[model samples]
Target: MTTMTPCQSLTIRVYYEDTDFSGLVYHASYLRFMERARTEMLRSLGLDQRALLEGAAGAPIFFVVRAMDVDFRRPATMDDLLTVETEVLAVGGASLSLEQRVSREAEPLVSAKVRIVCVEAGRARRFPPEVRAKFERLLPDQA
Candidate 1:
C-alpha cells in the first residue's frame, strides 16, 4: 500500500491542439497531461518504459485504466501554463490508485483519482518483484 505525499510538478503550456470549441481545453486532454507527467516522473526515477519493455526481462508492462473519478473545477483556457501534480494513493497487488490534478497558476482546474491495473503477457497480473523494487525506492516511509 502507499500513502499520499507532495507531488513533483510538471508544467505544460496549453496549446491550440489541446483546446476545443470556445477556446477551452477538451475534458479528455487533462488525462493526457497527467499521463505525461507520470511518465516523466518515472523517467526521473530511471524507469524508462521503453527500456523496461525491451530489457533483459523481456516483459512488457502496460497500464489499463480501471476506474476514474473526476471533478471539473474550472475551465482551462488556451495558452494557460498548467501544472500536473501526481501522488500515489495506494498500491494494490495488481494496481495502483493515483491522485492527479490539472492546475493553472497554482489553482486547480481539474482533479481526479485514477486506478490503473498493470498488464503483462497481455493479461492483468500483479506487479512483479523487479518492478516493485524499483518503485519502492520512490515511495515514502510507510511504503
Candidate 2:
C-alpha cells in the first residue's frame, strides 16, 4: 500500500455571509471551510464521521481539535472561488496532525496546521484498530 496521502480539496464560493463589512472573507469563515475539508478528507478515507460520532453499542467516538496554528497570508474577496486543500502530516496513538491551505487558484490565502485527538467518554483515547489502520495508510514513511 502507498504511504503518501493525497491532498483533499473542497471548493467554496465566498458569499456575502462569509464576508465582513470590508467585503473580504472573514477569518472565521476560513476556519469553517477548513473544517469541512478535513471532514471530507476523513470521509474520502472511508471513515464515516457521522456514524462514528453516533457510535455503536453506545460507545461514542469523536475527534476534537487539540490545537491549530493559522497564517492569514492574503485576502479573498466576496464571490471568490476558493479551495481548501488538506493532507495528513502525522499520526499518533490518539492524535493526528494535518496541514490545510486555502487558495484562489494559484494564490494562497491561508494556511494552517491542526492537531486532532480522538476521544471517547470525554477523554482522549487511542483510536480503534480499524481507524488506526486506515489512517496509517495515509502516513508518510518514517524512514
Candidate 3:
C-alpha cells in the first residue's frame, strides 16, 4: 500500500439543497465536494487546470475521471460543517490515483478512491512534465 502525504482539505457547509427528503445529504453531493477538493489540491500545487485545458501551459490537456470507487460511511445533515480531504496515492505517466475522504469533525462520512486520466485531443496522453513533477513531489520516499 502506498502512503499518502499530508492531505489538502476543504471545508464545506451543507445546504438544504444538498439534502434529500430525509434531510440527509444526497449521495451525489459528496461527489461535488470531492471534486472541489481535488481541484483545490491541484491549485495548491500551483497547477491551474484551466490553463492546461486552454493550452496555455502546453498542448491542451484535460483531466477526466477514468474510474472511482466510493464508500458511503456515515450520513451528514444540512448545516453540518464537513471537511473534504484529498491526497495523492499514485502518479502515473498519464493518470493519477487519489484518495478522498469527507469528514464531520474527524468522523468519516465518505471515502473514495479515484483514478483520473490526462487526455489531449480526446485521447489519453502523458501529463505535462511540470505537472508530473509537481505530483511526484507528493509521493512518499521510495526508500
Candidate 4:
C-alpha cells in the first residue's frame, strides 16, 4: 500500500444549492469540493494551473481525471462545515494518484482515490519536469 503525504485541507460550507430536495448534499457536490481541494493543493505548491494550461509554463497542458474510486460513508446536510483533505499518494511520469477525504469535524463523510493525467494537444503527455518535481515534493520521504 502506498503511504499518503501530509494532507492539504480546504474547508467548505455546504450550501442549499449543493443539496437535494431532502436537504442532503447532492452526491455530485462532494466531487466539486474535492476538485477545489486539489486545485488549492497545486496552488499552494506555487503551480499555477492557468499558466500551465495557457502554455506560459513551457507547453500547454491540462490535468484531467482519469479514474476515481469513491465511497460515500455518510451524508452531509446544508450549512454543514466540511473539510476536504487532499493528499498526494503517488506521482508518475504523466499521472498522479491522490487520496481525498471529506469530513465533518472528525467524522469522515466520504473518501476517494483519484487518478489524474496530464494532457497536451488532446493526448496524454508526461508532466513537465518542473511540474513533476513540485508534486514529488509532496510524496512521502523514502528513508
Q: Give the TM-score of each candidate.
A: 0.85, 0.90, 0.92, 0.94
Q: Model 3 clash pairs?
A: none
34-61 per-residue lDDT for model 4 (tens digits) = 9999998888878888899999668899
Q: Taking the tens digit of each residue's C-alpha lDDT, what string does model 1 give over 33-123?
A: 9889888766665566777666433577766788989999999988999999877777778887778888999898999998878788778
Off by over 4 Å in 1: 1-6, 55-58, 140-143
Error of 4 at 50 (Å): 1.1
Error of 1 at 136 (Å): 3.3
Candidate 4: lDDT over CA atoms?
A: 0.91
lDDT of 2: 0.86
State residue 83's C-alpha deviation in candidate 1, in Å.
Answer: 0.8
lDDT of each: 0.78, 0.86, 0.89, 0.91
lDDT for each residue of candidate 3 in 36-143, tens digit (9 for 90 to 100): 998888877777888889996689998999999999999999999999988788999999998999999999999999999999999999988888988887765521
Give candidate 4 misplaced runs (Cα > 4 Å). 1-5
Task: Give the distance in Å from residue 93's predicted Cα in candidate 1 to where it truly belongs.
Answer: 1.6
Model 4 weakest lDDT span, ten residues long: 1-10
Ranked candidates (lDDT, high to low)? 4, 3, 2, 1
